[model samples]
Target: MTPPNPQDALRAAAAHVSRRRFFTVTGAAAALAFSVGLPQAHADEPADPGTVRQEPFTLGVASGDPAPDGVVLWTRLAPAAFEPDGGMPPAPFLVDWEVAHDEGFHRVVRRGRELAHPEFHHTVHVEVDGLAPGRPYYYRFRLGPWISPVGRTSTAPPQHARNSAMRFGVVACQNYPGGYYTAFKHLANEDLDAVFHLGDWIYEGAVSATGGSRAYPAGTLPAVFNHETVTLEDYRLRYALYRSDADLRAAQAAHPWILTWDDHEVENNYAGAISQDNLPPDEFLVRRAAAYRAYWENQPLRRPQRPRGADLRLYRRLHYGTLAQFDVLDGRQYRSDQAFGGAWARPGGDADDPARAMLGERQEHWLADGWRDSRARWNIVPQQVVLAERRSEPTEAYTVSMDAWDGYTAARTRFLDAAEAAGVENLVVLTGDVHVHYAMDVKRDYADPGAPAVASEIVATSISSGGNGAERPASYDRLTKANPHLRFYDGRRGYVTVALDREQCRADFRVVPYITTEGAPVATAASYAIEAGRPGLHRV
Candidate 1:
């Protein structure tokens, strides 16, 4: 049928705003349109049986991967008796959407239809397009009568727009047990053009085995009592608990997000077929499919996430006002299995074997092409982990996750090599998941001090996954000191705000005191700037 009436959508949405709820998740039976053959297992189940009968929705709403004319909106419609790991009854819901120029639904600009069904675990992803470029916009969702909380979004500048400066918040790894998302509150409040979730969007279900804990501020980390998240239900619970955080909701409301998956989004140091920390190969593909699909569903991504088994394309590109281009890469999928486990990685064993690839052949080509074709003044590769080469001095153990650039040394070298070939000026690597921040000159060969700096790497610390802000003194201090190319380093729980101007790109490392509590204030720990045509980063 036609999109649930725009007025109906607003009434449903307005009702949610009245509740003073920033994220309103509603679930109902006729959620999905007929004809999307749901599995029998899912069909014979009750719909919308959540504990809180008064509320029809489940979880909240979020948006990501924004462009000048489009952005991805997301939500999960949990079925009745939803358990942690799959096997819950199938849920089918018709997710209605609305976009307004004002938060009060004054000017309804776009309306759309999305199907939340069993085929995709009841999670809704609607990528709305044709929005005004370089301007802020408000949005929300609707069910039969229930509406989601109002969220805000903005698009990238259209191609013809000129001299338009843009600001974005960069971050990753917000583990529940490590701390709270207190930083999210400030990130939401801080005016920004968009948000870049570099990676570690969600930790897997097997925290105990990962040498991590489950005690977060609000509630226990969602877990599968019997096994890790090998099924849809396991992944569902994981997102449910994560979205429940008020800080996270506020951040989701503030701006559109550009996201990618780090190892922990599925499993620590996991790759195509192998998982770090000793996981069975057989348990992986199915597990990955669930994780990938769940991740795609819960986030505001485009049609790319319409899962084809376990593989979802998280790699995407966004352009901003001819000033910058962002290539958000996926680090975990399409990578070789962990070459070495834990602190002692073994990538050197058959490291040059062409068969061994980190980004696989396709992603490698895609990145290479992006470097060659980008016309923006700056080219940003927003991915996970650090890009600076590891320099060893024998003072301590320094092992690279074979799943990281370190494991795929040859591949990363190729990427840099292509940049050189493409003459891609102002190449910058935007990284996350190390739980430590750094600003370093990216040399094609980290082993050579005399080697020219071809680009810069700005590594963002955790939103709140690592230890106390000062806990990892050695990790930050020692790394910067030992590596001459490393200009700045800090272990803080916060995010980065990068402001671009015609003169320079200034990255202000903003750290929140803590996320384990509400009302954490944000401050700039340091700032670094890369002058136009400089080719390398410099401390400001």
Candidate 2:
């Protein structure tokens, strides 16, 4: 059967949605609307009455993009998550939310109401403000008789305040069909200030009836997920399938998340508007628009993160008092196309071109300016790809991944140069995508063996993507030998926890033994630390 056109699907969804529900307010109008709160209605008096059945919060609740003053709380009214319309009516539904100082909600701090419009897949993102900074808060949603699971979130410390310590979890690359979300289950229990998810939240491929390695019952997942995602509805349903995982939901509820997409959220190894299959830019953009919109709908992001067609400005900076500054980057969105036909190629030609950009020209400037303006103790870069150079062949002539920073040599040099010029004291880059844990020294010059390390990079392994990985994969020895800057490597499935203080930053690589089965135990594969003034990784 021929697949439905993405543009047509988007247009059809838009046509069915009410204009009043679709239109969004901005500036003073938005401020007034949110400040006064949305029109409140009981579940019985819903705009589309009698449309909801079962529990509407099957996908669960989440919080994210924390600030000193506020955090965004998110939930979607999806009684049937896998359905084309998420089993909701074509009208808006009222969702009530409250923030409390305690999980039991004996002391309420903030309360408001928002409309969950079908135009946005019945999703609501409530940016709750007017709260004390650097304190934990519990929140939940109320839709008539049903109440969402309580979520824990916290605001960052005041901008100039001197924070003594901060901790966060780094995770990425969770492909649903490949394995279970056992890593997320473990991550849910970790004590973290926030979680940085570096993308590949969902794969864009088809799923088997038995749910691949998960070995679910033959008819467990809906048949709708057996095909690759293409349309807005397809992407929306895909997110629903992933979000249906209880472990993933638990982690999201446990801590506020700061997320950025790599590839596989839309398509694998996509660069800018270019797709891996090399489809026409216009056609690819339509699919991208669908993916971006669905991503925003499902995520706990603020209004500015919303997509305008295929474009979404995802790169931004967040401060944790004066202790750390997180520059969450969107590597897949603005990068130049991979050189020499992409992936595992010997560097030359376009790879050496001085004009090749990884973060785009505008973002490069923005990053440099941010570095110059930053006053935080540690400059933390939460990005999608590996920043340090990795040589696959242990020889003078080595091959590297064209899809990574190695593909843009001049751009990498410029980045290091900018950091040096900005006088960045402690630079720590947190990365995900390689599906293996790696602690490497970000050097000013990879060719110079004696060059001083300029930064430290901690690459977290996948949450589940590569199945049950070995302690040392086949390429482990060769890659580590070829790249002297690499301090440690582990091919395991799990997340990483980084703790930062006045003197040093330490990263603990936490790994689960297996993900193909349930109830796997987690262990610390390795731990590394970087001193405040030092850049290289030291085994701790």
Candidate 3:
């Protein structure tokens, strides 16, 4: 057989970094290698940097990845976000952060000073601890006398504590240039315990005027923001552009976010270290590392999730008392290169390769173990792509997008089988990417003519990725008819609001009528529920 292509070979090699090898790597050596690629430091903060001329907290503040004792606070000092250096001199600045029980900071619980280093775009990530569990807190950052907007976040309940109900707002795929973030504005208004961002938080490509409801002004398109992101600066600039949106900022401040990335955060349809343009492994790995680093710096994630070399540890578990257990997974990093060279491929042949994986070996094992050991009432997997099989055409001979779960039939089967064998009764798979909303019953064996539905998959619509979309496209109607397991489908821009309890899980498909303009009203396109015992969706 012809030697595997460079990308495939590279993936195989990377997958060999087993748990043993990962633990054996010296922390000092890893840190030393990681420090080499950091951008040059700017001047250290002087006693006073003269009259503070820049508004550093323009991107606003956010908190995410909440645990019972602590949550991660984030704010980047970007006065001019679109600029290469965010218009900051190379320097380390002392930024102060406070967590208070009240919005007025009258009862300050935790306060600290952190350095906003130039290397990470002067972003400060504070992992605050020693707070009450299952409670809300107000937080803000300060630079000199300037204070950021006070944001709200809550800690998860103690791991084994019993809680009656929990609510979450699921959002994803907000392409900056597509339209305004009216969806986020509405999402901020909802009363939610936390938010789960499934991925594509920022698209890495330049904006075009032809496809969106409203287009960015020509004057606002800086040279740095108009091209595909390849370097660290480019990715940082892309995130800055997205973070500048008022609605996006509001959504971030409204609740703590659980974040994981899909392809657009780096490039469209990229698999592992493979680029869409098919660049060499070494060259593409450099770009991958840059993307990973920038992703870490921009989000409200803890230090443990920071990128080490080209690897970022994102797949982990979070518990919300005894109500639910969240297995936030990373699907892009360790996945095998898409079959047919990352293009549309037939469902047989290489697509059936048992070695082909979406979560690689370690993460797949981790998820299975989590399923077996979970004690919460609900086991929710917030992941990147759809877990159920979806075909571009109805026929078995047709092609499917190899970038999704359909590309790895054996792996998907193995995972579903393991989940079923684990007796996971209340398993729910939440997904984003594909820019549409879908509610499907995840079959234990899709290939079996009489396969049983073992789980429910609710796929959220993009925040604004596909511009203003239709409520019911003709193709969507046909798709639902062809796949009986698919209960609901909509091509629109919005998100899914879910409430879980001991009895059942309720999902509301919230959609915005338009996105090209601002202040568009949101409506519930449909509501679905999965009872405690039954796995399929019951329309409400």
Candidate 4:
């Protein structure tokens, strides 16, 4: 059916409401849409729910932040996803949603309506509650005659229940122009209960019209995407482009995701409110606010994660009964500026300053408190950046990545100390953002060669970043030799699958050999098991 013109719909709706009320509502939404210098939409009437003609669910559906009672269902009305306003009029549309026990809506448990507001890019975040725990549910969205693709999600077990096993996937660093999302296609087929996206979800760099490494034909992407993203509309359009990937949409539809951001979501190697290029704090904050706002609108995040200016409270906890407790952290938002100028560098006195924090003081305290109260068998910390120290030269020179936990020596010590104080026996750190897979033993003291292992770290490779990587990069041998705690390392494009039981946590390093072309087969390049009470990696 031909869709009703947005202008016509607005004119029809204007006849129903007082002119003052119509302008009051539509003006507010338009103001928000153009807040970051995006072109203003024409002043119009309130949206009529029945007038929506185009299919609004072009970006597909997703579920996230699954609780014991329910999960958050998400979708956006993006009939013209590439457009700055997502092709919707500057108004609100009432969206209908349903949660069902089966794929078909015959066994629906809950159904409701929510307004997709233009102020939030017409995205819907349905925090559905009052459902049975530890069971799967199907969800979909509706707007007039349009229906979203069905998404499958499940809740955690009862808070204190003795859940035996929990399996999940860890992924990160999906640079849209770098390669195809071949790994995500394979990941979507995995038997995972949930997915932990450890940030760098979208790169903020410019995309060539040819689409970088994948090399799409000329004119495939718009000229607007050829420049760096700084404004709210820019970030939103970038997400729209990335979400257009079928593999990514498939993964989101297949399982719920828990996510946090790394530097590239705003600027590469940025720290806190500081921009990498040293832009003034106020100027950088404006950009950060835009990035954060677009991030929330695109992802399957709840209202609690919505951005308030440049600030967003992303660090939080999730429990899977007695099996595991996931402390998803935000390493980029509140961190101190990278010591000795970011990226690979030698340590300096500032790197060891106790006052400097990776998670900031407040979030550090929150994480420690959560650990003290956690009753789960395995305490999993899903966060951005590598937690273990990797020496560059495999010698005593002490060259390391200032962007990672290695740069914040005292902060790393504080984290381990707090975990130890809280009696966290089975600690597993899930990390991303180096574009490589690494299995390392978290040492009590990196300075001491004989230090005991305090925890285990499983770092997942990128979904498709750094192109198709090698099994062993040039410095692989040196890195392993330098850090004795480093058990395994691989440079490939894929994700990591983790399974936790009462006895042990197993990590399978899944890899796809090629991403420049589509349909690459995925395989487990390596596997390691971290036994409970023994915080170290054991090849299996």
Candidate 5:
């Protein structure tokens, strides 16, 4: 089957909806595509044959993609989250949502009713608009007398505002069974404009009970194939389990999120329609479609982000007044297969092949155009995988991780060269997916020993992926010494906080003492800053 053009896909999706019938969901027969061969006992039984007796908002509420005029509100009715169907009936139910200027909801701004269909797991996504820009708003969902916990969100500054600053909490790689989410509790209390989630939202693989510092709780796994998520229901259940965490939900309720996915959102280290396990393209595409749709249904994305088959238009731009221009990227969707069969090797030959594109030709051109047209003081690229040059051995004449940008050296060089040629200074790259903290300078050409730095990259550690990591890993000493552009490195479990303005950008490397148990204190292990027009980082 040929891939549908974006506009045609959107039109086809819209054609399925009938607003008069309250956005009718896909029928049960259609859902069977995701539920075939499942055990009857694990299925979500038709509603209790009566009214909803239990609260449907057990999974919590969230909002994202804030525009100057509005934001997108999200919530799924999952009274029994671990169940196959989120314990909802096969019928469509009415859900009411409202957005207000205050937490108390005394002053109502936007209020409306939308139907939740079991086919989509009774999830509701409301796009609330006509509000003031660069300010906070509170929202909630209701089903008759049951009301959801009020969630707080904010809009971006007006695109042309002359004086503005932006604060964002960058995080990624939260494996449920890795450890507890103590870092998220601290993140929820931060004074942030928005949260940049660079993927790995949920690990598609399963963990043994005796694997990490924490053990998998009983009943968390489904009765069917729970080793890896290969079906739509499997992916949905994984998301439901992750979202059931209180700390994660608190972080979602506290701020608007800008989310993008990495490998584990589907399968570990899988690229495009190719699986690392070497599954056939046609078979892998089916699994990809399931994971993609499940991802779309669970997150607070907008209409344009809706998945059609295995393709979704998730890459876009967001502006923060004149302070920053966010070119959120999707590196996985459009890319060539990893070189050297997706393993670490010397970085030359095929790795330097100009045809081995990472962001594909179209996205590369799009980013280059953004660099030329950008007017914001800072051009920030929030993406997965580190963009700096990282080598496994200090003496080896090579790089590691063909899955990272190092494997696409030509594309990386081209991207940086375009930014430099366009006279775009103040380029900041926020990265995740390495499960460690790294502050590096983006050299014009990593292969050139005398090349000048043109940008700064801040790579965040995983929230709880590797559990409670040591304060200092051996790689910290070796990699930092081997690469002078790499200013800092630490192996810890936490996130990165960034504050940007016209004059400078400060990044606080916040680390949690422990993720094995709850209530761990978070502290800034290190701090660094980049002054205006400067390309390297200064430890301050």
Candidate 6:
């Protein structure tokens, strides 16, 4: 096989973003929507100093994958109605960028400018190097006459570098058309070292009524909300609508983020060859391309993930000193088709179908290899969707959500078994996409409900997309109770906060009262802890 281009997956993914019309953010709160690309310097903005704004960028700012000597900086120039379908008329201008040691820009370190116009969303990414490791720094942009707000970012200590511990916020499934992003706002204020956006950042379709029980309608609700999304315009619209939220942008600006995607980013239960919606691979590729493109342009991913076509490989590893090695997996692109039935799918438990596959053949091997080499005391697998064994009752209840690991049991079992063989220590699985919260004891045999627990799973509730305070009903409760391995479950709208010490990793399931309205209060729905070396999780 040809060596996979480390950047191929992301670039292929970004091609989906419509580059026809580029929006420019010129004023405060101008409607926001845009995309990303490599450094393209403009002539309008003269090279200037730090912490100053000559031009205003409305989409805010963010950073990601910080290394001791380098970091990825991101910001988009958005104009009202920024869409590739001739939404925002193109305007040629220079976009400038700078990074400083202080908020005042008094100690200038790295600075460069990029040229941007319509047709690529005018988003510029600067991968700065020659910076100290494990340190925090502030940066901003200079657009024509206004400067974007100053944003803060940090660098990752070398894998072997030793020092104090670090903190990061875990978030996922913040679907648009559901509610506000108060959880992101809460995290934005906290002094977090990083944010792990596991997946489902945006539902890849129209507004959802699936949120029904918890949904607050903009006008009226769709009976099904087929909610088709394909064009570059649709994806751009979704990202613009999502980033328009102040809290989301603030959280992005607050810390460098590490990311991975779950199914909803494209559609529900999208396997490699098929989508839950039953679209062909070629047709779905059109949509997947758009989704990935918009995702890259909107976030702080490095230069590698820029739009290439309709595919963006999202699997990668992040090492934070000797403390941890985060093996972020891409569960969608190469996953197998969802298991046919639902809760009633089957009970004989033939997960060893030998035919069904999850994580695909390559990702499974990659994960196993990664685990074999994991040097951290903690091996955190931050990903999108369910990895835990779900023991739903013997009913015909099936979710079209084939995107989850529950939909591909054989592949999952193989991957888990491989991890077991790899001698991977402190295997902690962090996930989003189920919309509900669950802490499960990964087991070797689900057929034997009493199987010994293997790894630990902490499934975070959605950031907002679980609708407003939705529950999985009491019947599902029976499923958890029947599964001895599952320690906790809650179907609410919220986020998860993880705090790590020298010995254990504690996960706090932070739930918000409501996302339909602003200024909501947050309470811990639940929490779980895993001791180092011991992969099994226990309720705290």
Q: What is the TM-score of each candidate against the true structure?
A: 0.83, 0.91, 0.92, 0.92, 0.90, 0.82
lDDT of 4 at 33: 32
Q: How does candidate 4 fare on TM-score?
A: 0.92
> Per-residue lDDT tens digits of candidate 6, residues 375-494?
787788888777766656533453223345665656776777888798876778888877778888887776686576778888888788856765564556676656667777777777
Candidates 2 and 6: which is better by lDDT? 2
Error of 4 at 338 (Å): 1.0
In candidate 6, what residue range of length 10 has the lowest lDDT sum? 21-30
Local distance difference test scores for all models: 0.69, 0.86, 0.84, 0.87, 0.83, 0.69
Candidate 5 per-residue lDDT over residues 1-540, each given as its tens digit: 223235423422332232112213334323533653222434444333247767889989999999999999999988778778777766667788888988999999999987676767788889988989999999999886789999999999999998557899999999988899889999999999999999999998865444345555664354542477888888888888789789999999999999999999889887666678867555566677678888988999998998766678788899999899999999898766677877889877566667666787889899999989999899999998889888876676646778999888777988888898778989999999988988999886666767887899999999999878988886777787678788888899999999988899999999998898888899999999999897889899
- Judge candidate 5 at residue 62 and give its lDDT: 92
Tens digit per residue, CA lDDT, model 2, 197-233: 9999999999877899999988888788899988777
- Can you write out model 1's per-residue Cα lDDT over 269-386, one digit (the tens) per residue? 7766566644544445556656776777678888865665545777877888788888888777766554444344533553434455667789988988988887888888898767
Give the clash count for model 3: 3
For candidate 4, the per-residue lDDT at 230 reads 87
RMSD of each: 12.2, 7.8, 3.9, 10.7, 7.2, 7.9
lDDT of 2 at 376: 94
**lDDT (Cα, tens digit) per residue for candidate 4, span 67-90:** 999999999999999999898987
Error of 6 at 430 (Å): 0.8
Q: Mind sharing the TM-score for model 1?
A: 0.83
Residue pairs with backbone atoms closer than 3 Å in model 5 (clashes): 47-89
TM-score of the candidate numbered 2?
0.91
